[model samples]
Target: MDTILGVSKLSSKFQVTIPKDVREILKVSPGDRIVFIHEEGKIIIKKA
Candidate 1:
């Protein structure tokens, strides 16, 4: 099943805070690193 856990708006500084649900899904912490990839006309985000 495809679920939309969360969404965030881009800020003026081009930063978006990860939503709690999304953070939990990614299992990311404050100092954790994440990777953003642009593939197939979409942005893929994952924990690095």
Candidate 2:
């Protein structure tokens, strides 16, 4: 599988928009739940 990298800015409301490339690669859609894991000083996001 190809790796995709994208950058997004966090909003004042503490919301961030997932980049299009990532969304497509992860096959995530609107209303889908995502999980964030904090490890080794980094955050990992996965489809839930």
Can you write out model 2's per-residue Cα lDDT over 2-21, one digit (the tens) per residue?
Answer: 35587788899999999988
Candidate 2 Cα errors over 4 Å, as ranges: 1-4
By how many angstroms RMSD does model 1 differ from the true structure? 1.6
Model 1, CA-based lDDT: 0.91
Q: List the residue pairs that clash in candidate 2.
A: none
lDDT of 1 by residue, 1-48 (tens): 757778889999999999999898899999999999999997889999
Q: Report the Cα lDDT for residue 34, model 1.
A: 96
Clashing residue pairs in candidate 1, if any? Answer: none
Count clashing pairs, candidate 1: 0
- Top TM-score: which candidate number? 2
Top model by lDDT, which number? 1
Backbone clash count, each prediction separately: 0, 0
